[model samples]
Target chain A: MELVRIQKQDFSVTEEIELVKAVSKSIGGVVVFLGTGRDISKSEEIVRLDFEHYPGMAEKKLQEIRVRALDNFNIIEMGIVHRIGKIEIGENIVLIVAAAQHRNDAFMACEWAIAELKRITPIWKKEITKKGEVWVEEHP
Target chain B: MVKIRFFAMLKNKVGQEEVKLDVPENISLEKFKQILKKEFPAITEFLDKKSIMISVNQEFATKNTMIKDGDEVALLPPFSGG
Candidate 1:
């Protein structure tokens, strides 16, 4: 199954993988990348994170990344999901699953997908600290 | 008229998500930006930053890109997504 979505609800990795496996039985390896919110940054304690995205363009860019990954890598199929709105610390932020005939392709595609998402996706995060709210401008 | 959308810190600083300006037809993105700065005085500094980017019709655009009626333009700050 091919999935490219932006949502506010939490997702189940097992369910997503099951859907990916349904696409082809020849898939021998699957690599899943899950990015979660951490509580600490630059010695400050983060209470929560508010994620904002450009409504129509964010999804369009995600789909573009998915297409590029499929064409550039040897992966058979892939799925991507990003959570938006208010998220508590330790919550999931994004998920990427790359399915391929071998472990190398899955691993490579999964890494490349996450990097592209960070580089081009029109999503931003505001860190709510005990001191105050700060917009995270740097991509690290 | 062209619609300009703001997001993240730019939205907070500008105090609105979007605005429609009655700009002249076939104006360059740079010229439209000058008009936007005059209209929204608070975003002048942010607009000058090299990190800030512009998108026309949902794709990344350069200053030389031309703008016309009904085009959707977005002023994007640095992307900090995963």
Candidate 2:
């Protein structure tokens, strides 16, 4: 299956893992990382977060990350899914899953992929707080 | 012509998603910013704050990079997505 996905729909960890494992019965380890919106931002209460992405470019960057992760790690397969548009507090925001023959490879690739995705992907979020709106800053 | 795209707060601030311009060949990225500042005055303040990043043809670009016609240049605010 194609690994990179950018959609507004929420994702499921179990379903994602099933998709990967179904590809190969030899897969023994699967690591999944799920990110969700929180209610607080810098001590302020947030009602929701509005996620914006450059549709064509963001997907391209994600595909690059997926390719790099596969090349660097021993993982057999990987998946990346991110949610876009306005999301309420506690809603699912992103999902990543890695499958490998062993636990170490699955864990390492999943961690590295998520970190790289956060660093380079052209995705941004706007916080809708009680005090009004604030665009979140990239840490890197 | 080259297309310049804006996203996130930059899009809201600029009041539009994209603009296409008939840019001269071999214009440095820094000089391109000057043109944008003059044309879209709303982006001027954001540039002063260093709150935006530019990408040339979907890749992060340096000010020294040369830009030409048919390239897609995007102006982005700091990304906050996870």
Question: Which candidate has the highest DockQ of all?
Answer: 1
Q: What is the TM-score of model 2 when looking only at chain B? A: 0.92
Question: Can you give the lDDT of residue A1 in candidate 1?
Answer: 36
Each candidate's fnat? 0.88, 0.78
Model 1 gets an lDDT of 0.93
- The window of 10 residues in a row where model 2 chain B has the poorest summed lDDT is B45-54
- Tens digit of lDDT per residue, candidate 1, span A1-140? 34989999988889988888788999999999999999999999999999999988999999999999999999999999999999999899999999999999999999999999998999999999999999999978
Off by over 4 Å in 2: B48-51
Task: List, residue by residue over B11-81, the lDDT tens digit for candidate 2.
Answer: 88788899899888989988998999988898798876665788999888986799998999999787777
